[model samples]
Target: MFAARRFVLAARSAASIGSKRAVHKGIEGTPPMRYMSVAERIAVYGLITVSFLSYPTYLMINLDNIRPKGENSLGDNALAEKERRAAVRA
Candidate 1:
């Protein structure tokens, strides 16, 4: 019984990791945030501003959407993209 439980837990963790990897791959095809159009950036920033201002109260009310994506890969891509651009310019 204990071994079965451990197996299930390990399987669950592996599945979560797989999903995060899938999300990361999907993000890689997109242009980084800085390269996005002004309207897109403004919309993103507006939502971020509103989300920050709302804080815990908004999170509590909208638990589903507020949940973080597995690895939040966009931030990683932003830095990577910046470095790539700088390297090209140099």
Candidate 2:
């Protein structure tokens, strides 16, 4: 009896799966920007502008902190040391 009930449920699920239909259809119309008010549009644009500008502004303001400390790959420190030694010797 249990096996028969399980087989019936399996058959029903398989049949229902083949008959599935879409619940929500895609909307076709003008862009959502057309519905926004003037203030909302301005606010959205301002937020976008601030988001783009903030990173460069932050980088410029914290350049000293962001930059690597000490000698770079060019061996500027070694050259400076050599110049100092030469000056001292002279």
Worst 10 contiguous positions by lDDT, candidate 2:
21-30
Candidate 1 shows a clash count of 0
What's the CA error at residue 80 for candidate 2, in Å? 13
Compared with the true structure, model 2 gives a TM-score of 0.46
lDDT of 1 at 20: 79
Candidate 2 residue pairs that clash: none
Worst ten in a row by lDDT for model 1 = 22-31
Cα lDDT of model 2 by residue, 31-56, tens digit: 77888999999999999999999999
Stretches of model 2 off by over 4 angstroms after superposition: 1-27, 71-90
Report the Cα lDDT for residue 81, model 1.
Answer: 97
lDDT of 1: 0.86
Q: CA shift at 44, candidate 1, in angstroms?
A: 27
Candidate 1, TM-score vs. the true structure? 0.30
State which candidate has the highest lDDT. 1
